[model samples]
Target: MAERVNRLNDLTPREWIRFQKSWFIHNPPPREPGVLVHPGKFPEGLAREFIEFFTKRGQSVLDPMAGTGSALVAAVRSGRQALGIELNPDFARLAEQRVQAERLALGDQAPQARVHVADARQLDQLELPPVDYCLTSPPYWDMLRQPGFETQRQRREDGLPTTYSDDPRDLANIADYARFLDELVAIYVKLHACLRPGAYLTVVVKNVKKGKRMYPLAWDLGRRLGETYLLKDERLWLQDNVRLAPYGMFNAWVSNTHHHYCLNFRRE
Candidate 1:
């Protein structure tokens, strides 16, 4: 008989059961001023959790929309090879610097981390090995351009960009929502070719709110990508640390959305 293979998460049965819960909380650590410049930055700790759950040590991980290198840093710290692609040169440089710093702190034994200054739409053209897993967070459709967001106003006051980048190619800059979603989905479809069979892909995203209209970005992507890959399940990442604001209060009900959907998919 063939030798039984070991295919399991790097967690005990009890620990794995805990992670299987539908929802969990993750209040990110306070970001330094330098890293805080990015408008939308996920936590490295959160990325590490997903990386460790999906990939084994020394496996390759890819983040096509690597913002500030959070996923890459998590991969390196987890002793996995990582590659990141970013469209903005400044953010790509910052990601590279952060990855280098992480490598230095991790000593010479850690696996490699590389950040490429390129568009995620052109992922197929890049020379990358078949990745064991992919984790990324795409832009939430042009909502940053709306003036009603107080956080965006505050960022503008602080001399930081309210949107991701000025590049016309940036999906976040696309005004039409349908066009943006189509393009973004196309990019993911292109990336599908680079994943090893049975590898998992995780997309951390939230629905968008624009002028009292809710766009179901997460649900939309889930349905769209389901056509190509097996839609595994969704894990909620809740944030209780954000202060509550009375949005549309006394006029209409608007809950402060403090969670993101971690959409999981498997390459069949």
Candidate 2:
């Protein structure tokens, strides 16, 4: 009899089964001072686990909204090629520098990671290599500019970026909620051409709260992008380390939301 082949990833049965759990608590370490300029960034540690699970070594990974190259660095560290598209020039430059530093530390045999300073909507024109996986996250529909500027007050005082950018092209700057959802979905729809068949894309996001209104950003992305890619299961990424805030105090019911939706999809 022939032996079974694992077509998806190079993980062992034990490791694969472990990842099958729907929820995980991953509290990442503090960020380096250089990358702190960007207001939001998913940890490289979190990105690596997903990248390793979805792809084999040497396969290529793409991060459309690559903030400071977290996903790119993770890809390189996991022995895979990395491609990042960052709209902000300052963040893009920093991402490239981080990637280069990672490569130098890993030596010549390490996989290469590249950061392109351009709008992700035009990724098709970039002529990037076929990607085996994508790991990214979108802004929570201009929540940075919402009523609670308090979330960003510290970053502002420290002279860091309060939001993604002042560029009107940035999705985080789009004021209308419906338009924001459409624009976000459009980027993924265009991404279908660049992916190989059976490629997996993981979007790390959360719902947004504007005063009393709730914007289901994660659910909206899953539903809209389902038209372009196969909608797969999602994992809950729970963070337990952050200090809880009194969102509603005594007036209303509001819990300190500490979980993000790691929505998974496949390009079939």
Candidate 3:
């Protein structure tokens, strides 16, 4: 029997994107408490896939918006050094604990991973080492605010107001989406100084719909950041685990598919 060599010509552009999505199609099993504490965190499997595809072992990887340190965990698991910066104090502490626990289990050879409680927008002030790759997911604008009150998670946790969706405070607080976008772009721009040339930056973001208005957040991010770095390709992260839409009950048309646009760029 002969070995098979798959050629790029075997698939069309759309097919190639679909193929990549296929590899990550399965839903991540619910995490056990003490293992991971956040729902917004990216799946470790996806983070590992990005780290493996973008860099070699021993290389350094960074995740600025490292919610629960998912990317950091992935980097360490892949034998790459990892650094994460988080804005939320609770999430940062949780990430630090998780990494420390993992280190205790995996020993020193596992990539050194650390998470610091700091604003992603202020990386210039943080003493972070150079990075070979950066993978992160930004907070989806206040969709949790859809209801008048806080999110269940926010409510369950004392003093933590509902945020990142449908919340008035979360959405209303950002009076300038343009400013928010610019600030995010500037953060990555600052991060570019730390990346090795040719290193890849992957951002997972999605468009937002509110009040019948669409914010091309993902697209605009690409465009604005494109000036600082080379705007490369994108990967669509399709979630298959969401409940079916209930458009029939309201006689409305709603999309059941939740997709994240994984934008890949390179430091120039």
Candidate 4:
């Protein structure tokens, strides 16, 4: 099949609505008021799209950083077997509970889904099946932390944290951009072992702006993982529902009309 060429602000109205339905906007329901570094969870609609695009019914899908079970729930909804590993014990338990609750709510409609509390850096210890498709979004450093005094002041009493991974050893914890890229790429290399031959791996990531520095996370991931897997293509997740940017031409030349890159790779 010919790859789809997507650019920011080029999606059709139908495509835009499909993106909205597949994933919820960044706004989430209320939670305990604490700094949630990685509190932002993915919507099931987008997850289902990746799951359906890469796997068949009853195929196994794995998520190494299964935050809150978004990908797992989506896989189940698509009638695919799902497995996940999370480092945080709290998040892992939450993911497990959410998967079970989803199954109960879905009744016979749900596929087999399971989640384990494990670190992405040490997938070798975890006994996971050969995954047909591995789809996930890793932490985007500490960008989740409150940015400036003005932004912090605007934050609500109960809001998501600036960084999700509390692990001191997490790749997001590394301050050096190069080191962060190396370690993050290493995690994906480890994941390469868990994928079946000729299977697909889609990573949902984006470059991050922190302290006036740009960390090209998505680009680096594509470059590094491309060494092990074929750099297939990318699809942009454009969001038209986001608040308009105020600094496009003022003090800062920021363009924030909503978009994320879905880098696709295939294990050779």
Candidate 5:
């Protein structure tokens, strides 16, 4: 039998217990004006929690789908080296600017944060070091393109793009759910090559809703990726701050889904 080593070098027993809880509340800070252009940005505070738990100081963390550098910033703030690859040139530059600001603020002690402009599908082509941990949030399928979403409507009115990028390479732009999942899973499979042995990969995602049908995106990813890596468990991220609207009122039963699955996997 192979020996099982403890991976929780940086976390205390109490902290481990806290993270083990099935669900927790995380209301992200108001999106900074600069990053508001990326409609699906995750919270830096949330990213920090995962980074700190999974890695020790000076270890490297990677975000393959870094949108405006939330994961990179969080990794640096948590005293870990950071790398992010963004597909959109505009978003990649914005992420670089944000990382630069973070480094400047940290002065001499700032950990390295590098944001690369590249397609996540071509992760192997990039010169990346073996990462200790990965924390990222992929786009929730093609939900950004749906016209009925209030957030999408607001972004469209503000002259921002409703989708991630106009480029066809952007996974969010894929209209077909199955094709999107295949491409996304392929990206993760490539990402698995970059992780050190026993390292953790945390993906923050939510099941998507299009028209009247609900797609089990998070569940599907968990099932597919589980074949490649050990499915450790999942933590639910509940959002209490967002204003809830009646998604399907009167005729059908549609509850507001205010939670996201923080799927954790380990490379064995």
Candidate 6:
């Protein structure tokens, strides 16, 4: 009998099966001060889970909007090459600092990680190598700038930044929803050039609400970006540890959204 071939990743059968479940609860641990300086970033642990499941060791992983290099650090931790593109030079420098620290802790066994200071929209100009997997999260359509936004409110009181940057080109600063979606899709489309054929890309995002209107950013991306990359499926990242917020408790039905859509796409 021949040994079974696992083309996607190095996961054992049991681990692979477990990752197939469509929803999971992962409450991120407290952020270290170095990374906490960034306004928004997914946990490195979560990124590693996706990286380990999507590609084997020594493969390359990229995060186009690498806020503080969460995905890059996760790649090195999982024995993969890491590449990242950060728009803000300040954040880019910070990401490099964190990556270097992580690599030093692991010593020579750690894979190489590089963070490029550039906008993701200029992906094609960056001359990046084709990658095996890409995992990233775009800003949630300027939700941080919305007055009285729950998350930003807390961030403000803590003296931390409530928004990504003041750069006019930053997607998080775009005030118009339609324009923001178009530009975001364009950036992802450009990502196609950096992804090897059959590579998978996972986008972690959620819908946003402005007063009574809810914008389906996740669903919209699934449809629009599907034109450039195959819309494979979706997994929900549930956060159960969050303290519930009383939003519109007395007047209307407003849910304390604690789940994020981890939309998976593949380059055919």
Largest TM-score belongs to which candidate?
Answer: 6
User: Compared to the true structure, candidate 2 yields what TM-score?
Assistant: 0.97
Against the true structure, what is each candidate's TM-score? 0.96, 0.97, 0.81, 0.81, 0.95, 0.98
lDDT of 1: 0.90
- Per-residue lDDT, model 5, residue 182, is 99
lDDT of 5 by residue, 49-117 (tens): 898888998999999999999999888888899999999998899999998888899999999989889
Candidate 1's TM-score reads 0.96
Q: Can you write out model 4's per-residue Cα lDDT over 1-268, one digit (the tens) per residue?
A: 9976542224455855665443434432343332143356667777886787677777889999897788998888777888998877777887787778778887877878889887788887887788899999987765555354233334444463445556887666677778778777888898888888888898988887766566788888888889989998888776665557465475767656366778889988
List, residue by residue over 60-102, the lDDT tens digit for candidate 3. Answer: 8899888788888888877888899877677788788777777
**Predictions: Cα RMSD each:** 1.9, 1.2, 5.6, 6.3, 2.9, 1.0
lDDT of each: 0.90, 0.91, 0.73, 0.74, 0.91, 0.92
Q: Summarize candidate 6's per-residue lDDT along 1-268 as a digit string, tens digits.
A: 9999999899999999999999999999999887667878899899999999999999999999999999998998889999999898988998898888888989989888899988888889988988999999999999988897877778888899888899998999999999999999999999997899999999999998887989999999999989999999999999999998888888899898999999999999
Model 4 regions more than 4 Å off: 1-38, 106-110, 149-156, 159-162
In candidate 1, how many Å is residue 47 off? 0.5
Which runs in model 3 stand beyond 4 Å of their true positions?
A: 1-24, 35-39, 148-161, 164-175, 248-252
* Candidate 3 lowest-lDDT run of ten: 164-173
- Best candidate, lDDT: 6
In model 5, the worst 10-residue window by lDDT is: 3-12
Error of 6 at 91 (Å): 1.2
Q: How many backbone clashes are present in model 3? A: 12
The TM-score of candidate 3 is 0.81
Estimate the overall C-alpha local distance difference test score of candidate 6: 0.92
Q: State which candidate, 2 or 3, has the greater lDDT.
A: 2
lDDT of 2 by residue, 1-268 (tens): 9978999889999999999999999997988999998888999999999998999999999999998999999999889999999999999999999988889889979887889999988998999989999999988889888656565887777888788899999999999999999988999999988999999999999988887877899998989888889999899999999888887798899878889999999998
Which one wins by TM-score: 1 or 2? 2
